[model samples]
Target: MEWFLFQLFRTELIHREHPSSPMRSTAQQTSSEIFLAAVKRGAKRRARLSQKILAAGKIFSTPIASGNGEYLIDLSFGSPPQKASAIVDTGSDLIWVQCLPCQSCYTAIRAKFDPTKSSSYAAGLPYQSCNTSCQYNYMYGDDSSTSGALSFDSITIRTSTITNVAFGCGHRNLGTFAGAGGLMGLGQGPLSLISQAGAITSKIFSYCLVPLGINKTSPMYIGDSAAAGSDIAYTPLLNNIVNPSFYYVGLTGISVAGKAVNYPAGTFSIDTSGQGGFILDSGTTLTYLNTAAFTAVVAREAPRRPTLPWCFISLVWISPSLPLPPENIFVAVDTLGSDCLAMAASTGFSILGNIQQQNHWIVHGIVNKQVGFKTENIETI
Candidate 1:
């Protein structure tokens, strides 16, 4: 069997609708289970996101894509490798954990960063030469602004002992990221733990996740030659975007209340970096929509809800019904609201997140410029 590690993030902030409800129903459970069972085949998935990040409690945080963050990972650093609470992200790839000296390591309720701890502590960091020698000064807005110089140390998870995790050490405070310790930049570069490991040797790095929206049945796939479904649905990649080596997916179509509205048929882009709004990002924290897209979805979802309100949480919203089951999924919410109900608009459902992609097999063909989306049993491609 192959080896991998799971990492978790302690997310405390979210932008969700304000309404509350009882626990998910058995019917919902049945649906979720059916969807997830098909997605999870022979792989194990770990937690990869923070527990406190969701506005509507853990449910909203369920099926988190990239917004859930890297709560777990494949045993790259070499340690037994902790469990994951992940948000399968793609915009970037540099798996790491919050270490000690964590001035602002996410919410206090979540895991605290302790540098003094980790038996694998390898220090002698140079913080000043970051932007010039490192990536950039601007971390993503969604990321916890604890920016600083990137570290060139070896971190070992269990499955594959990754050296030079591309992990960043924080400054005295969060210069950019809101209040998080450090981040695990997971893309296709040295920043990626797997990719970095691959650099040292010739091993390829990859990963996957199990979705809660799928009733904790489906397993998202990463690394190796692992993939879930056959009769999958895939959309072609757009003409232009950022990095071609990115774990890019495709934009199938965007609908408003079951009505298909064309955004030029090829306007969507997939980013594992966990950047951007709701239109194409599966790994983002919130389901942000462009003005036109948001308007259309909201109008269809909550026709009766008020247009503008004082607080973002007080709005009524329509939950989107999915054609596919959950699993093979990642959920998203509003700006950073603590309530999922508030983020809902007149759209048939909230932004299509981990909830809609349930039971579907998704593939981030990093080497290719396309994503493969497939139903567990039905091969769309």
Candidate 2:
């Protein structure tokens, strides 16, 4: 069945599984409902990686670290393009950030939230009517319980500084993410930046991420969308439960420890918002691979797991990849040499999350109605 990308309501959501690592600190929030309403349904096909490492004329964002161990994005909102520091999350849909006169502020960062700041900042920008079934609330179970407000405004990127595009400042914001100011929701919605840009007739997309442990040349961009161009190739968007149309990047390849694997890591991906422990995230601190895949890695490194009864699960790298991994679940990555897909899941196997995605630039692109990926700058690659 082809997953379709339609309007998003509050009733669709899914829970994420925990990681393989036993002792780690992560967020307390967990989603249990499955979200497939907005999935872009299509058949999967094979594709090659783009020869270019980085796409030309790319669109990106400048992500800042929050006390919550997550990255905060500078979402464009309000009049004259006031950039607010919000979390660039794919897990949820309500993209909200702290309003003017925040309770606290970033040390080196500044938010220009002036109610009277610009000609575009009109008092009471008016709420949008949910005509397309695009109602959203920020509650845990697919119900946009948070029920953020919809204030219309103009937003510009720091690069070209384009003026006056249809953007929104979330109605409500929570300072939960490690001293985070707010959030920039990246899910499929009318509120997403994707639906805001007036410049392109076709759909435009952008991502702002900082490679973990790499701290130089963190840049963001606008227009000249990489996902829309061919310089960066892509495969078809999946219609599965695990990898919704959340922009999965096809991997040209992946390596375990210090050696490059022969087969490429096919497109089974998603851009999770901010994951602490037992969650998915951008720039997640570690790489969490499938137990079989990860155990193969561990055996290569430590040879064998601790001689405990359930210390480590024995796994083999599944040569043939699946179009979709699974649904309503996430896999956890235990240490390299651990046992039985060490998941906190009392039910099924481990669901893959961020632990398997550390130290990599997972990219996204669209070509001939498809998306793809290619990992770069590794000891093995």
Candidate 3:
């Protein structure tokens, strides 16, 4: 099997809809699964955001896509190489998978990795002093959790085979990861796949998420392979002091119908304290803004409309012939025949979700701490 230390792979989103038809039913179930996973991820993020705010003045100033469905890619671990598909997530760190001798686990579509079978599997990590046997336990917003031992083994990605790569050998696992074996977290944390890749990957990656229901392969590139051209627009990646794990971007203002809306300046500012800003998250399905900004945008986008959902519906009736704002700022939900962007109001921070990121080339330059966006269709090409 060929693999790259840093490789590029194509992925597709799954949808489950229409119970009458078998294919459609499967797609519908997949869609529901994706939606539920996204909701749980959103709730988890919101709770973390709230925790950061509550701990602000005190000692604990803390913490805190691509497709309408989950983004998955194939990877292998161990010496003999137990190959399995894993979800590519940017919201959380720590790449983990269910291992064999399972005490309890979800109904997996692939064979689980057995550390005992791999000749290169090391039961303990050198980083530990006394209890070198690595172990981890994590819980998510949807009440799902996983507990397992850490293993240092050979991991193969295409043509590149890396040794001593640390990953979780999950024994007790649960949650929405049914069709996939585990999650490959690409978040900006210490334990993420990107971070673990270390000098081999050059701290860079890029992805182009296909729209929902598009049965095509979307691509993800690592290292120098993620090049860009002049047609791409670049945005400065901002830092959220409280939540360094997220990819924050400066969102100056939003415009509608080719004219700037009447929202205040500091609406999306990142001050010294890292309060009030927006982040681009691939795990989230819908864009979200502060309640104030969301309300104003809704009012202007559909004036005389009382509620947000109603306003969105009203936009569908508006003449498409009318010129609209640039897509990077305002996204039109064509599936609903509506000009309204699929965004909502939040109390903590604004989020640029995968819904708005569709069909765009998103480059994450972790080394430079900047993110670049370009509008293009890599799927068809």
Candidate 4:
């Protein structure tokens, strides 16, 4: 049987042994928790970016803190193939998993990668060298870091076994990543999976993350399967000369309740200096805007005193008492203590996070240098 190399969904915590698990009753509240965590994580990422801008005069890819990205993918590694779950992040490079002989590592939900058990383990690939024994130390904005040996081994995703896959075998790992074992680099970097497997993926990838709480599965597609239909809205992908590893998108403006909130032109533009502009980060749970842009958006959205509807069990109903616009289901104020739209008070750049990207077919077209978005339903996807 040929395992088609397409469509991996978010890993559910309740049922790890079964592939099909029904969305739990507390899914809506769980979604809110995830969103709030993403907001906090995004702020940390912004701080790190600001520091890089001030010190190095250029930006670089940084590992997102835990609770930022919500997408979870499952794959296997080594000769016998140890199954593991990883956070899918488009902002950071370096696909890594906790390895054996851990010096200081967080507890993983699954078994750690053991190179000795793998027959195809190689001493080196391009970035991960086994011969000379390369080491990678990646520090996050939150002060958490991962240090490990860089090496090569075969990785299996579905039916496809990608050979000579370069990845980090983390021995010293710490942070708030509670359930996930490691990270899968979907970013636009040399060490990222997309770049490493460019010959097979053809520089294309797409994903439709099913809204949190929904029982449906979200699928990630690579290569020709990532193409979008004509109805999808497209924007050109901007180049960040300072950090070529990130996927920058041109964000003209934002609309609330069908009204355009005006901000200065080039508020989200990236000039030759490699500053400003927005990124489409699957790892970030909430959308983030620069101070000026965020303030303007909040002013426009705060005035609406509408009631938001929520679903309980399998039924959806309107909650007239809730003080939020129907369109902004994820928005919260004061009592709920979560931002319907998060603000980036710490950084100059804006981010189009995954919260705003829910129930949408998001495409990353490297060859075309464009990103496309199309509204979708979880059931249909």
lDDT of 1 by residue, 1-381 (tens): 232343211111111110111112224333334333322310111112221112112233232123333222222221333322222344456444444465444542234334444455344344664434553232333343334444544454333344435565543333322122234444555556435544233322222223343223233333432434344444443332333224433334454424564443223333343332223233332333334555654555454234323212111112212243211212223235222221222121123333343334545443343445544442121
Candidate 2 residues 1-381, lDDT tens each?
121232111110111111211111254422211111101000000000011101212354211211132344444565556655554454333445445543433332345355457676543334455422232334321111223334444554343333333333333433344334455554444455544432341333433332222333222333334422233423444323332323332233334333543421422232232111121234222224433444444454353233333222221222212121111112222335322321221111122233233222333222223332323233431
Assess the local accuracy of residue 303 in candidate 2 as a C-alpha lDDT between 0 and 100.
39
Winner by lDDT between candidate 3 and candidate 1: 3
Per candidate, the number of residue pairs that clash is 113, 55, 18, 3
Residue range 1-381, candidate 3, lDDT tens digits: 444555444333332222211113243344434444555555565655455543555673234211112456667888888887776777667778889889999876678888889999886567655246777877654456778887788877655676777788899987656457787788777777777765677667777776654565566766653554455455566666655767877666665544555666677766666566777777666677888878887777665333433222211101111111234333433446344455778765677777567767787877777777776764554
Report the lDDT of model 3 for residue 266: 77
Give residue 287's error in model 4 in angstroms. 1.4
Model 4 per-residue lDDT tens digits across residues 65-94:
333345667788887788887767777778
User: Order of all candidates by lDDT, from best down to worst?
Assistant: 4, 3, 1, 2
After superposition of all CA atoms, the RMSD between model 2 and the true structure is 14.7
The list of candidate 4 runs beyond 4 A from truth reads 1-34, 52-68, 126-131, 225-230, 307-346
Q: What lDDT would candidate 4 get against the real structure? A: 0.64
Model 2: number of backbone collisions: 55
Task: List runs of model 2 lying over 4 Å from the truth.
Answer: 1-69, 100-118, 121-137, 140-148, 161-172, 198-211, 220-222, 225-233, 241-245, 248-283, 290-301, 304-361, 366-369, 375-381
Each candidate: what lDDT? Answer: 0.34, 0.32, 0.63, 0.64
RMSD of each: 12.9, 14.7, 6.5, 7.0
Write down the lDDT that model 2 would get: 0.32
